[model samples]
Target chain A: DAGITQSPRHKVTETGTPVTLRCHQTENHRYMYWYRQDPGHGLRLIHYSYGVKDTDKGEVSDGYSVSRSKTEDFLLTLESATSSQTSVYFCAIMGGAGLAGGNAYEQYFGPGTRLTVT
Target chain B: TQLLEQSPQFLSIQEGENLTVYCNSSSVFSSLQWYRQEPGEGPVLLVTVVTGGEVKKLKRLTFQFGDARKDSSLHITAAQPGDTGLYLCAGAPPGSARQLTFGSGTQLTVLP
Candidate 1:
């Protein structure tokens, strides 16, 4: 298990409210990713950060945004929460960017945060 | 879009039974990884196969990457209740190492 933790293990909010999920890692990994897991959809990437202030959108980045101001924290924000945004959000870290051998690209995930929009 | 399609969306079996879950894709991948996720928890890395036609085993679980590098399979022999969880397969494309295209996943329940 990696030293990764997601704040707010569970949360419930209204549809129009704004929500932010936080991911903190103690490993100081180079790559950090945010993903959502829903039934029949598996895990879909929302955003990822390669370094401080360097982030990119992913396959399911329509309504989500991310920021990485520091090395240890990656934040995912939902500007206005929607029922469709309810899902288990996960944070993961990879030591190498597919450069290191011996499964260095393999990701280590946090426990996950469950969000519900009513 | 590059997609990894997993079969047997839902599975239920008694302990000691044997089962296989598959992940297929049309695009070749640079590497393939399998993960097992428990309820309320993140997916944990089970194994990664980078070489085509590679086979790796971990105790009762056996994983194989297709020779084409476009598909993979996971077989569990004499399943136990501890195996109950969601099994996801993700493929890494060449060049970019940003995000992984994950399969729909298979929810497996092993009843004791």
Candidate 2:
């Protein structure tokens, strides 16, 4: 909620379709992350970007991809969405220097985007 | 994969009662963080505890990192209706300061 906004707050999509979620941050944080929250899973990281175009997979990277073309925008793409992917997606940005004495570990999360697949 | 497990998946307590939620793991972590999420909203950071056996408090909520750095606990005193929400614990594994492993979380409902 700290200067972070996610687009398409709620979406209902059918199976076998492609879906993309967008995360925009006004703060120029160097690190960005994508996570999914389900009923039994608190929050699982899908992917993360240390900088523009520098991305890496997270614990639950399968069936998902991410890209960061600009510093302020990070996008998560679900190729051929499945019912298992239906969950609340959240985007987070790592706080930069001067925040909490430059620890850079605290994450600020976006409002979240809920995707329902049938 | 390192896993953080939380206890009491669901809790319903009366106002003015005290409760404690736990987050345990077999893997050691460099630091641990606590967060609370409300309905239809993103999780908000509550506290971060570093160092073995470290303790931090925020008003009525007290958080303690385990001596082995593999577990943590959150204790709340005189709970109120406003405390109803999902509490999550996340740990930062050593050598990766940028990443975190989260627990399933404990859903708390404090009835007035």
TM-score of chain B of each: 0.97, 0.99
**In model 2, which runs have C-alpha deviations exceeding 4 angstroms?**
A97-104
Worst 10 residues of 1 chain B by lDDT: B92-101
Candidate 2 lDDT by residue in tens digits, B5-105: 99999999999999999999999988888999999999999988877898888999999999999999999999999999999999888888689899999
CAPRI docking class of candidate 2: medium
Query: Considering every candidate listed, which one attains the maximal lDDT?
Result: 2
Instruction: Please list the residue runs of candidate 1 whose C-alpha ends up more than 4 Å from where it truly belongs after superposition.
Output: A97-104
lDDT (tens digit, per residue) of candidate 1 on A1-118: 6899999899999998999999999988979999998888988999999999999988899989999999999999999999999999999998563432434278889999999999
Give each prediction's DockQ, rounded to 2 decimals: 0.62, 0.61
Which lDDT tens digits does candidate 2 get at residues A1-118? 4799999999999999999999999989999999999998899999999999999999899999999999999999999999999999999998853233324288889999999999
Q: Estimate each model's TM-score.
A: 0.95, 0.96
> How much lDDT does candidate 1 score?
0.90
TM-score of 1: 0.95
